[model samples]
Target: MELIKLGERTFCADGPFKVGVYILKEADGYSEVCIIDTGVDEAAAREIDEALVKAGFRVSLILNTHYHADHSGGNRYFIEKYGCKAYSQKINAAMISNYDICPSVVWGGNPVKEVLNNYFYAPPCEAYDISELEMPEGLSIIEIPGHCIEMFAVKTADEVYFLGDGVVSVDTLKGHKLIYVYDIDKQLESLELMKGLKGKVFVPYHGGITEDISKLAEANISVMKENIELILDICTTPKCLDDIISEVFDRYGYKLTMYKYAVEGGVIRAYVTYLYNKGELVAVKEDNYIRWKKA
Candidate 1:
């Protein structure tokens, strides 16, 4: 088990995954553990469990930084094994409770489809049996909704921020041939917030690690602008989400992957949604589809 000692009483699960789990050791032969995020599966749970045993800390609680599968996938297992409560932002709670696809990765033909699908259809809502956040707890929850709505970061003692997929390293994003979000502007706003942070360590979800978040934030913004320009240069006519995605990505010869399709739609919708909010675009809510056009 890889346990990284970060300052006093704080340990991070360093390599393989950058998810940070904080440990608070008490002098009277007791300890309190706050989990920032859970990794892919059971391996993560056991590894973390071992780390806690070594640190002599009791797993009192596990708080998901967000609902992304990489972050929240192991919630049930961890909570059950350790008898600890689990918490996430309200929106995330809704996602977990509703079993939304946003937090769970769905690749068609993946082996876990049946398991994931069954989990989705399981009895009543998934139990959210954990306490919410408070400043006195030494973790400040900042709501940054963009990449995923109801997104948040945890600021541990002395300005250590755990940005949950809010912003990512440009290079890491580029490798996927795309990044994702439902609203680019909101994502940009979220990134802007990261820039203004006083914290020295910026733990972005996908990026390995970053202390100079301002530079990373600015670079992400620049990429967004470039993508926007490239997209707009060709979207001369009014187009729907699917049409834009097929044209922009397909025309560019980029692999029209499942994640890419979602990203392209999200990027277009972000612009459209932003315009709608500003009264520049008009949106009419239909039963299953919402129509948007220049206001």
Candidate 2:
């Protein structure tokens, strides 16, 4: 992983997943580093540690945007090795400390063995409530919820924004037709919020950094609307949730897997709730099955 400097003190480890690193100089002639998000596992954390060590920095704090495994998976490593202070929103902090809650929530119950891998369950790590953390000078947190519950975007004094899955790149949108969204309505609101943000550089977790994020935000909004419309069309004929999931996955050429069924299935359920609340779709319970149809 290459550590690319964004500002005087802001740097990012650019790799499969961008990890934000900010340096704060202490009075005792020591430089303490803050990590924005840990990557998928211990290996990713090791790479980050090596990169930061070679750059003459040591991790002292970790701020997880949310409790997804890919973002919080390395929390255990950092906390164990460096004794780093970790923080996230209250619920996310709880889930981070109890990693199994992640897969259980995604699966809507106790997840099976197939869904309990590193992708869903990170090694457990303790985290405090973000609200309780004392803010360092020039570091601020922005609440950007949509992709996940209580997700945050970190802004440095240098005006660099580390957007935590707020908006995805056009290439990512094209590659993965369906992006996971916890709340479709809130996701749209967060995208609108991002357009008005002033930043020297914006770093999205899954995409490259850019000076301007307006176009990227618009691209994500467009894809979200398209998914909403597609789901509505699929409901033109009354269909059960399973049918909708199958049709949506097949249309996007996604192979059926237990993992996708849990993750992507949750995304579909979010759409269903969004459309139902908007009065665009109606649910009918018949013969012990609930089916949805266009209103």
Candidate 3:
């Protein structure tokens, strides 16, 4: 993946997920750089290294926005190659260090061999909890969780916010109707939070860089509400969770593979939980079957 220059010191590498890598130029010729949200594998890490070498920058540190494989998969390569300290929030740091917790959480159980591959699980790498680590001068960490557990956004001194997966491109929304999310309620709240953010440019991992992200955040919230309405409409009668997911999957015309099933099923469950919490839906066990129905 080629690196696209975002600013005087910032660059974005396109990959399965757009990776954000920043180079902070020191007074000396030796530049200090930070790799944010490594791509899905070792090759992605290599690409980032190559880009840095070509630009005459040295790695000083690495940061992970969350524990997702696509965001943290290349942590092993960077840590081993440059011996740079990796930092992440407490929960994500634990998941990254453990590694297996990622696939297990995503699959909601023991993941199959295929799901255990690099696409979902990465090798363990040592990382420090962000709270314990010293925030480098001029950089601030923003807590923006919703897409994943305790996902943090890196706001550079240049006013460019390296938003992890808090927001995605519109094309992505069209193609993948259900963006993988953990808490729809928090997701909505975070979107509102992003709307009020003061930044010159915002860069989402799966989207392009823009001066304003309010519209993008709004689109994400709208799509989430649409999905919620779909589930609510289908729950006129008590419907099992599996049935709800199947119906939503069919409506979106998305393929039902193991990975898709796990990810999409999780999103569907989040929708149900959001509605249930809002008192718009009720969960009951009828005939030994756990189902959700409209309140």
Candidate 4:
């Protein structure tokens, strides 16, 4: 992982999955070094620790934007090393502290041994509920849920916003074709909210930092709308969930692995829920099979 200094107060540890961990430099030395998100495991945390040391800052606190392994996997390492306080949104704090709940929720049932691996679940760590605390100085926690249950964006006084999977990069959208969202309705609303953000720079977890993210936000919304329409078209014949998933994947020619299957299932289910709630689709029982059809 390469740590690129973004500003006097901001630094990014660039890796396969980038994380924003900012430091507050003081005249005497460094006052507090705050971690926005940890990478997948201790390995990522090691790099972050190195970056902190190089910047002459003592680790003060670690904040998780959500409970996903890629975002909070280094919680144990940071907490054990610095004895720092960890904080996250209420729902995410509860899940990260437990750990098992993440994979369980992802698989929609008790996860098998394969799904319990570090890729799906990280080591448990304690986190304070951020909703209970007053907003920290020089930082504003913006709720940007939907990609995960309680994902948030952190805006620093430096005018850089650490967007936690709130708005995906254009390249990610083009390559993956479909992004994950637990709540499609909220995800769409979050995308719209992101459009009005005013900041000097935006740092996406998986994308490069940029001054403007409006184009990327628009691209993400376009993909969601396209996929919803595709699913709606396929549901004209009262298809089952698996059928809708298959049709969409086949149309996009996306090969699936066990992990991808689980992730995509949640994404498809979100679209289904949105359509059902909007009265654009309805669930039907035919021949003991549950299917969805146009309302």
Which candidate's TM-score is highest?
A: 2
Q: Where does candidate 1 stray beyond 4 Å?
A: 27-30, 100-136, 251-253, 262-268, 275-295
Task: Provide C-alpha RMSD values for all models, in order.
Answer: 4.9, 1.3, 1.6, 1.6
Q: Least accurate stretch of 10 residues (summed lDDT) in model 1?
A: 116-125
C-alpha lDDT score of every prediction, in listed order = 0.63, 0.89, 0.83, 0.82
lDDT of 3 by residue, 1-295 (tens): 5777777777777665667767665747667888788777888888877877776777778889988878888888888888888889999999888998888877778876657877568888778898887887767889999888789899887787888999998778888879989888888889999988998889998766778789888888889888988999999999999899888888888778876777778778888988999999998887989899999
What is candidate 3's TM-score against the reference? 0.95
What does candidate 4 score in Cα RMSD to the true structure?
1.6
Cα displacement (angstroms), candidate 2, residue 105, comes to 1.2
Order of candidate numbers by lDDT, starting with the best: 2, 3, 4, 1
Error of 3 at 255 (Å): 2.4
lDDT of 1 at 22: 68
- Give lDDT tens digits, candidate 2, residues 21-117: 9986653555688999999999998998889888888889899989988998888888889888899999999999899788887777888677788
lDDT of 4 by residue, 1-295 (tens): 5677776677777876667767644536655778788888999888877776776767777778888888888888988988888899998899888998888887788875667767558878788899776766777888998888788999888888889888878877877877878898888899899887898888998876788778778888999999989999999989999888888888988987677778787689889989999999999998999899988
Top-lDDT structure, candidate number: 2
Cα-based lDDT at residue 84, candidate 4: 83
**Model 3, residue 164: C-alpha shift (Å):** 0.7
